[model samples]
Target chain A: MTLRLNLLIVLFLSFSALSFAQNNEIPAVDVKKIDGTTFNTGDIENDGKPIIINFWATWCSPCKRELNNIAEMYEEWVEETGVKLIALSIDDARNMGKVAPYVNGKGWEYEVYIDPNGDFKRALGVNNVPHTFLVDGNGKIVWQHNSYSEGDEYELFELVKKLSEGESID
Target chain B: MKNYSLLTSAASILLAFTLTFIGGELKAQQGIDDVLNNGEIRGNFQLEAQYYQEDSLIGAQDVPEKILSNGFLNLIYTNGSFSMGVRYESYLNALLGFPEGYRGNGVTYRFASFTQEKMSVTVGNFYEQFGNGLIFRTYEERGLGYDNMMDGVRVKFKPAPGLSLTGITGKQRLFFEYGEGIVRGLDAEFYLNDGISALANSKTQIILGASGISKYQPDQDSRYVLPENVGAVAGRVNITHGFFNVNAEYAWKANDPSADNGYIYRPGEALFVQASYSRKGFGLVLAAKRNDNMSFRSDRTEGQQNLLINYLPALTKQHTYNLLATLYPYAVQLNGEVAFQADLIYKFDKGSVLGGKYGMDVQFNVATANNIDTTMLNDERTTRQGYTSDWFKRGELYFQDINTQITKKFSKKVKGRFTYANLIYNQDVIEGKPGVPVIRANVGIADVTYKFNMRNSLRTEVQFLLTEQDQGDWATAIFEYSYAPHWFFAIMDQYNYGNEDPERQIHYYNASMGYNNGGNRITLSYGRQRAGIFCVGGVCRVVPASSGLYLSLTSSF
Candidate 1:
């Protein structure tokens, strides 16, 4: 009986510790926006702007399209709503050199960063790419999407517009 | 102080009582508990035992008689936004027929992991794979007794609606400890849908991704300057429209040679193309792949056993039958292979003559691989310059096969299936060394199942194989009696009857019964397990012949 009790206690403690750690881990950054520069999550939400941070890579075809599409409408989106779009590139050193060139060639106006170590990526449990998260002005993630088609972006923008206007998104 | 102590005692006692209750319930042989219970621990376990005996016909003298045992216990707990689990494995002498050094009983993984909205993290041992697993794949294979668990840290995040990122760093498993090399990787995917203002109404959809992995292993050998930092980049794009879906990827790895080629560096590249069309009851799939020296690794000196930094995708069917599967299992030779496979499935409409009382389903598949043509060497004097190996040019077809299977049902109680396949294999590259007969073979199998009632059924299968080389011709038969939700009895036999030498012949037979009660299943059988190559992916482990009793038990809690 004592042995069983001890085992149970250990199990409970272990899970409790895990739960606590999970809630406290740093929020995942938009790998496409990091650019090796240190930035805080609060910086984007400081101004009343809703922030959309996307973790992307140069070779990721879906990411490339997603970034390019967003870039085409980025300026208009900023003017319409106080929303900041940040692209974090997760390209390692092998392909990191191509990040600036690729972004420049695309003529995207949004901010870009690098997370070569994937510190921000690992913080989030992303299994597949083209995953997106929408953060409120308070820096709390409220909505997330996995894969995207052309039509899905319209729905996402609608949600972002609603969220920026203080309308219910869910 | 006295009041505080009293409260603490009460809380502890309550916790103890709760644990005891759960443990007591578990001791009664209960099913797997739901993991949603934030404070409860759930687990599953499996154990197997086998004995081996040598037969002189195939010259199986190197075999040894031994008992093999392997089992694992996993405990998982989740509370609110946090979750964690630890798995312990006791391979103890592992399995005699398996690779060496897998013979220890220890806690293989002690992990703490958690996930929230945008971030998820894991520390300790984990299993992971990247992009068709061409660059890095760490996992476990019980049947083959191969586990390359990585001990490290991993994280994944998504900061926007169309982008996702992942990063990992760790060392792969070598027996019970970590391998000598360090592996690190990054992968990201972006969806173009959100950014494409003009393509919003287009019927076509596209997703693109890129990934990179680097492996670092310190080398002490003075003779060779191995690419200490082996790296690879992979890109994939997927598009779908109407009934058509296509995914294509290209991966390239820097030059890093190995013991197979005496450390002569050769770069590697792999290209994958897959397309499928599915609607209603009809589905068609086409896949083609080309692999050239894509066997990335951390340690070039190590044999084929460890230090594999990538897994070559197999283009052949993973057969499960005894005779057809054992004769020639395909192994992806990373250095050179170009293969393609096509699969078609069509179901006959009801009320048709071929469909009879029930619809009939037909499946056909064909796959083949060949070596990449290459100049053995430009000249003996050109020491540093590597051999010229062309990426294209179907050298000699190393493997080729086609299979057709049909399943049909008559009335409600009778059903049957017929399968036929023709296969060819190159024994030299697949079986370590040459001189063994290169196999050109045809196999046919027929299976019939008859159900007398809701609870009783009988199944019979017969197989005939015709081959002129290797182990000669073969015949097989199996009969099974099953009672719904409870018991099953079966008898199986296989004979190598067409061998040239009379003494080089063998017949294997087994009778077994399996009982399933609730969450527990137990099986017992006595027979001869033939010596054959059991493979997963491109890797293979030879399962030696065994003539003995076998038992297996599995349960979850």
Candidate 2:
């Protein structure tokens, strides 16, 4: 057990050092808006503020919970840091019909888009939904986290605040 | 010995590079200004393991390999518009409910592609899906041990704005090797919003698309002659006007007898139509679909959710509550079925009667699927037409669900969500059981969240399902605690109190803890899992009963 733990630690440390530290803009991919308009996700910008990109699905419980939590403080977040939230539904054709209704019914004010074919998700190398990323104004991915606990939004909000204040998160 | 040496050499080289890269970071935090101008490397890894134990009461038995593990590592490198990636996957003895065919480990997926102006080409394994995947789709669902990505070449081209074309020729992946059949397909799409000047930015937008796919395989069966080559064609149209959007697709396939449809030499047909309208506070959507003998696969004899060339999703609500999902989840009827779904969403403004301080959101969805009315033709053996069916006629009720959910924020720190779902499921038809009666279940869920501080919170879920069919009534309670940025703990229990056999009534309990740091996470759990269908986005797999310890870790860089 000790040896295994040691090997794991070494592996983790090695990856942390050699891993890609890319400050890449969102890839140019065609995704549809709830209103049926097609837009390139890479063309989206925030005038040098932070953008919260969340990948979610209607069937993922954790995703809904995190989104709901963010909705409660969305107005304050926008007012305080000029941060914007973009929610992408990876629902596919099976439940693509429910994306619009589910979004409106949830009363979330975030900018919503549908990646019915998961083109954007694949480009980002996202393995699961509920994956959240903090993209800086320059379109560089500043930080990211997987999974959702009850209080995760607090951590995310703090990062947004920092990035908006011109604090170097990288 | 040769393979062992190759693996060792690869590991050493990787280790040396990592150490060299980290030498500078160890002394000083890598500055953003310092970036390698040459290229960029990124990847992710996930590892999951479970330790099993035997429990005779539930028919759970320990595997010879007590601890089974599955691991995946993906590495990608990019320079300008040119890029390459490879995925290494290992299934050490595989896991419960996972296909045992993936018992070993190797580099299962690899691809290299580059974009040059308006054209790009990819070589090696790739995932591609046509419009709504009615005719052809190649994808991977790792959790289900499903990966049928094509191996060969794919090309995507665009000569003008609003017009695009794609072509691919490949052999589908079957387990560790390529399948016997060869597949070729091409698709053309035209977008009016981009192509035509008058339609540009117009309230009305239209997109037209067509696709054709063909598969070739040598017939080996002597009992019945099978077509050496089968073809399918599909067409789709999508239009949007203001808040209203309409989309439809139809596909037709040449007759190719297979075991799935009892070797019936009848042409396959599928039609899908959907429309939706949405404004600020309200949205409405409706969809209809009909499928007849439309099971297409590269391998002729492949059955039971293997080597599927297309995806036919059930037009129904995808429930999340465990009981609501497992007991009556609807499987898309592949052979013959007609289905329809409708959804309505409304939001009551804040300060309104039902909105209180925070607005109230409500959504209701209803869907139903039934057998297509069919009658056998005269001289069934001689007539190539297996059966006659009306496009719109509906027969027995295979599945039905009506669910509604409401969300309201009562206070600054308290938020609640409530849901009610009623389902009617035909167990015999869906589960392929002969005598089981239809199951009717009503389920309710109350979820509440409490925030005590800036960094601390608690969430609770109370769910109850009432039914006399299946395993009787079930109730579940879950509580979770989170400390922002770092830690989370949760406990849940499902009690089957209404089981017919009192001795069999038991509590399925689980507890878990998670630690998160940046893009990395690790979770440890111990639990008793009940046998049921575990689903994600309407796709499901049967998870056998088990008592085990689970560990999962994922990291991205």
Candidate 3:
């Protein structure tokens, strides 16, 4: 039994190493629109512009702060780079009802969706909220961040600027 | 021993099958590019370890194992419409305040699923929930060490664009084992606008759903006669028109005595209703819920957040502030309770008098819970009917809170939020404290952020609580500094100063720093943690007060 377990672990590690070398893209999963209709995540697009996918929840304080900060500069970013931001709320059934109201109350201009059962969240391998991902015009994920801090939106905009200008980021 | 061998064999078979499939695909394609282009593998990993130090002053118990750790890794492979995943969990000796059943390590979850046309099938472990989760739900909350995933087979069929059906047969997971009962359920949902062509373009949209669930457990007890089979049913409806929405659900369960309700044979019932209205800068929500003898479990004798077959959502504002959240968190009373909540949010314009230069946002919320009025029967022992409850009478106050918050931008580089709250907590009922009087308290907080440049910023919070019972008055202060996309440092102190006994009045201080780089985060901190109840969505676990050094790492691909 131990031998088989060891073999499985070794194989798994090697597979992970191989996968790490490949370019990752967003996974296709089912989410809900703010109006209570099912929407396929594969259809998310920004007309060949950079797309910023942000995973957040209504109850997470840092997630709210991050979204609010980005909201303040979203118009400017769009005008300059033709960027689009999509906010995904990972609120469960208990708190799902408050999401639309909360978003409307804040007057946020970004497109918002709900993942009530966290199916999309799990497919994306998201461990925590406020995890942001930057996707290039070709639909390939280029950069991602796990947590949020003050002034992080500035850094995110910088990446968007680079991606729009056809500059590579390491 | 037999179960262990069975699981090991199953895992080995799965691994062999996967290897064989990959080999065959490679041979058929004559290259690895086909598999690499169509197939994807993704997962996440998290680990938390704590080194404990005994502190008799704050009631932190000595640990025989000075170091404890909890960790898990998930790996999922998906190819087109087929996917398979597994999770390996390790709890070395289990962390303090966690269930002792998590002593070792194993593959706790494994599943294979496929979708073809409009039908989906899942075999092995899965998580599922019915409408509102009133009658059935199986999920995981890692923060509370709670997971009730089902080891089962499930089938879902979408007959049309707006109609769906699901059927499931499984056994609920209990720690490293399976519950004694076998569970089976069926659910159906219909969207009116999508299902009927006539209503497709209507202004009003409606959705209706219903579910039925049953569990079978063998009666083996010698002391009393028990029912072997229990069943529950629920129905829900949702309506939306313009900017208004309403959702409601009702559930009922057959009488099956269990440990949570003191072996009462009374049937269970629950009702939840919510209404909301929202526009661009204004929103309002009102909700109410009532539950009676609704603690349904697969096992008859299990207690303490275990083996729950249904979820009773707590109707309260989930506070985010430390003092307001951790100090007096409310837990749902599964047996019987009536609760209501109201919330209002409004945002002033950018250039208005109250909005200042940037804009201002205000939110007001109120929530309350009360015990169900009940009357004991004359021959309750013989009938085992327990007691009868009045449908409209409220017995006693369980919990209440009224709070409001205002957020304003002072300038281009400054933003602030202020909050005030009043709370009334019944210690005896909610916390299981006998003979303790109710606690009435007021809390206030001010949080502000200052930006020095585009890359550097600092945020601070000052908070205070005034109370005459329990831990008495308290104050807290927090400071955090961030350097853009990479690093952050935070420090906070919580002081209990108005205790009758100064010896018990102590200061809990903590400092932490974190580093984040694209999909990976690492944090290390050392601090004195005050004992409190930590909750998520009304479900709670007691977090013990401990002085320790903590480290955590999370990563995803």
Candidate 4:
């Protein structure tokens, strides 16, 4: 027990010098669109509105639930806050072909793309699915989270509302 | 002296990385509003440890190291279109079921990349895949102790809007070192919709791709002359019209002999196809595939799942429920198999009879795999070609799964889902244990959630599985409660009800709690885990049987 504690403490101290400042530019990487064209993720321009990027897959049940929940209120959220949601599928070739059909069947109106090779997922250092990022008007990632439960969408909408109103979320 | 030198060099590199990251952080902290367009540093860290106990009946043994830990830190630096990254990994004695070779710690991965105009180049280590990974793929899955990254140079050129060419030459990584063979590959993809004016702006679009790979290894056998150079080639096409799409790929390999195939010089072949039609509130998909002697690896003597140059994902649904996942999981039979899968998803309109006040969603999926019919040749013992397989013939059933699920929202704050599955698993063929009777299982699950308020929720899941073979029937239940954006707790228990031996009918119980705060999470659990195959994306890893406490942490910045 003592040895494990010591290792934990040492690991903690090594990274104690800094906490993440969420004000960093998004990693620039190539992700493909539904039309089979590639574009840089950092080039996404939403006319100074906030953009919510969600990393999901066709097989993950929790990811689908979260997307469906958000999709239920996406139209209202966009109308109220002018936010744009971009759903990025990290599905490899095994299930990459199912991504489009799955999303369309869910009746989601968000812009969807495929990270067929996990390039963007790796660049962003995402460890799991249902990872979400909130970017400000200047393309700086302002907040992020992983995983989701029921009623998590309201928390995200609150943050989007704050950003749209030009107020600090933290 | 050599070991000491390697350790010192590795320590110095890690220290240097820490210093550089600290300096970058200090500069950015100096001015809150100052943006550093010159460079930026980002990274993530994960640590997992477990304590084990022995159970003779379950086959779990005592750990020499009572506590084993696995950890890694990934650091990446990016500037405009240029980027570089390194990964440091450590396994202190390694956890149970992981590769014993990874018993120490070091920097295991490094790479640098730059892109200019329509061309890009990467030097050092990189991961890549080609057209469904039928012919070539390099990747990593930490939980499975699998990493086959390439160590060399890769370049990509896109001279035109619809055409792309990629070339790579390198040696694959085997554990802590490089494989003994050299691998080279080239791939090209062209989008006909963009290249041909007639297809542009039409309802139909077409894309075509091709890949070729070769590995060169020195011949060491004195009795039989081994082929020094082996080649594999693949071609693929994708076509899409309004509300419908079709994708297919075919791959072929030269005569190659290896340990996994009893050293038979049989050429390999693989074919995969998928079609789907989807629109609002409705979707359907069908898939078919066949693989024959398609195990291509860099080293001829290697066995098990290591140093593979291609991937063959099972054309079956990746289950999520614990009982459905752990009870009778399926792994791809690489030698030869024919598989088919179909899935359907539909949602009923709100306020309708079945839709209720909210809405109802239904999904159905079925998958089956069978052995490919083949006949042994009279001269197969010493001939170059081992056997011949009939193109359209299937021998015997290998596996099958029929699953149906329904989801409905009862109210604004209440939702429920129900699922049922029936499976047929052939342990004799897939698990290589002949004479063992086939295992058939049926599973049912119900999950419900209720929201007490905007920030709090409670969820419950009940699952039951019945099987006549293997360990018998089992029942599982889970209770979870969460406070949005902060904390959650869960408790679960799985009971073996139908075991013949009453003493062995045990409850695998566990309790866990986690805290989350903006890209960071820590979870602690104590429980008994049964031995089973834990898989992600169809690739599986064995999780040994053990009873212990586990701790995990993940954070990114």
Against the reference, the lDDT scores of all candidates come to 0.66, 0.81, 0.86, 0.83
Cα lDDT tens digits, model 1, B1-557, are 64344334433433443344345555321211222133434344667776545546544343343666776766544333444555567775676567787777766765666666777787787766665566776755555766676788999887776676889999888767777888999988766664466766667766687999988887677876667888889998767675566767799888776674556666778888877776555767778888877776656666665667776667776565667777787877867789888777776766787867667777787989898777776543445435677665778788888998887767667777788999998887777666776789999998877878756778788998999987789999999887754578899988889988777678888899887543356789987777788764345788766676788776543
Please provide, for model 1 over A1-170, each residue's C-alpha lDDT reduced to its tens digit, 9 standing for 90 to 100. 77455445544554455433332212423333322223444245527557776777754544754675576477888888778877777654323434544454344566777665444543443323455667766565656654433334555677679878887655
Off by over 4 Å in 3: A1-17, A20-23, B1-37
Q: What is every candidate's C-alpha DockQ against the true complex, given to 2 decimals?
A: 0.02, 0.35, 0.53, 0.33
Q: Give the per-residue lDDT of model 4 (tens digit) for B1-557.
A: 64354434433443344335335655423321221224466788889999887767666788888899998888776655566778888899788888777878877888777787889988889999888898898988776788888999999998987888999999998888889989899999998878788888878888899999999999898766889999999999888888888889999989778877767888999999999999998888899999999888899888677788888878888888888886677888778889999999888889889988888999999999998998877664468576789988997889999999999999978999999999999989877789989999999999998889988999999999999898899999999999887789999998998898898798888899988888898999988887877877667777888888999998877
Model 2: per-residue Cα lDDT at residue B149:
87
DockQ of 2: 0.35
The residue pairs in collision within model 3 are none
For each candidate, give the TM-score of chain B. Answer: 0.89, 0.93, 0.95, 0.93
Poorest stretch of ten by lDDT in candidate 4 chain A: A14-23
Candidate number with greatest DockQ: 3
lDDT ranking, best first: 3, 4, 2, 1
TM-score of each: 0.72, 0.91, 0.95, 0.92
True contacts kept of each: 0.00, 0.44, 0.58, 0.43
**Model 2 chain B worst lDDT run, 10 consecutive residues:** B27-36
Residue range with the least summed lDDT across 10 consecutive positions in model 3 chain B = B27-36
- Reference-based TM-score, model 2: 0.91
- For candidate 2, chain B by itself scores a TM value of 0.93
DockQ of candidate 1 is: 0.02
